[model samples]
Target: MREGFITYKGRNIVFTDYHTHTNNSFDSKAIMMETCQKALENGVEQICFTEHFTLNPNIPTYGHMKWEKYREDIQTCQEAFKNQPLHILKGIELCEPHKYTEEYKQLFQKEHIDFILGSVHNIKDIGLRKTLAKYSRLEAYDLYFKEMLLLVEKADIDCLAHFDLIKRYSKEAFSQDDFEKFEPLIKKILSKAIERGIGIEINTSTVEALQEPMPSHYILTLYRELGGRILTIGSDSHYSEHIGRGIKEAYALAKECGFTEVSIFENRCATFVSI
Candidate 1:
């Protein structure tokens, strides 16, 4: 077992990382087996492969993921770990889910997907980096959150990933105070998510690159204040070396924000594990 896991209700809580990618994802170089092994080595008992699945033509990873091949790889990994300590789930992290309702409707019919993560990686058909250069810093942030609100309402997703992704590339520096401007919209998104039984993801990849989680501590506090409790922590690791990275910190932040349990999904059904 991984050491230093947080204890709640007189038991140690093992975290499940729900957002991950493998070589099937266009931008990732991590092999599926290697990623799984890394997660197991880190003592992550449950790991979901939420690979990038996008319909946006402009996305570099748009047509890269082949459903059958990806499914086959996951099946192989599942068989390899069947009697092992880790639980592997098939998941997809879809970009701009609000834009392709019909496509997703058809895709899921044949896919054995367990969990889906909705993300807004573009604005007006442009990718994040270009979009940031196209608009003012604050405008870009507004655009990102505005679309997120729409995504929560329109997409059939299990959770929202990387809540404030726009900040990842903004030229202008930002801080928690800037989050105030979008609080109302974010609250609306959270309300819609709760109403729809969708959860929010705490992506920990940002901890190494930005020294903060995508949603940041302020946003999490706001989520708790709004009575939002369904949360999932993800490393968002694109490589084996980074798998399960920063997840413990993410879980600790969740606990600090008044969350007692963290969410995990199996065959699209969400269950809570005490933090």
Candidate 2:
């Protein structure tokens, strides 16, 4: 088991990482059950298998799992680890909500998903990673924010994942001025998210690996200022070693933002943990 980030209320808080990818996600290499086993071995009390669910036809890396096969694999994993102390919750990481809202609703209605993470990984038909490689950093950031606003308003999902993930791959340095330019749009997205009862995620994986936490400090502060209450933290770990890597820092940041608690989901309901 990995010994990491045990601080919370002066006690060891065993975390349930809610954003994880397995082979079911096209770009992931680890199998579902293997990922769960690693989590259990790493002292993770619980985890959600939030594999990618994408609708960008241009990106073949978009999820390719059939519903029947996906469910079968999840059930198989659940049963394989049933005797363990760790809990595995069924989840999906939704990408490009504006383009795939109907598909998402259909998938959710057709299956039993314990958690859903809404993310904007694309601007129109292009993936963020690809966009960063081809366009100017400012151009990519603007498109990302614009598309994110659309996702916040249109997607029917639980939590917004890595609110400013596009900035993670930027070729240029981000500044306070850049954040200032996007502040109004950020507030609007947060306001709509609050109105829709959608939760925001403090994705630690961004900082742990990508070197920039999503939503950035300014955006997170704005969310708090707008009276937003529900917030969840995720490692967004694609590999076992990265699980729970920066959660302690995220919790500290949340506390500084005036958040008294962090959120977790089970059976489609949110439960709070004191920060």
Question: Best candidate, TM-score-wise?
Answer: 1
TM-score of each: 0.93, 0.87
* Whole-model lDDT per candidate: 0.84, 0.76
Find the candidate with the highest lDDT and give its number: 1
- lDDT per residue (tens digit) for residues 1-275 in model 2: 01112222222345667788877777777777777777776667667878887766676656486667778988897899887877778888877767777876786677888788888776667778888887777777778888888888888888899888877776666565776787887888899988887889888876745565776777888999899888887778877666666776887888888898876666566666776
Tens digit of per-residue lDDT, candidate 1, span 1-275: 01123222322349688889988998898899988888889988888999898888877768989988898999999999888788888999999999998899798887878889999888777888888888887788888888999999899888899998888887777677777887888888888888887889899987876789978888888888888877999989898888888988888889888999898776677767888
Q: Give the TM-score of candidate 2.
A: 0.87
Model 1 spans with C-alpha error above 4 angstroms? 1-13
What residue runs in model 2 are displaced by over 4 Å at the alpha carbon?
Answer: 1-13, 133-135
lDDT of 2 at 109: 73
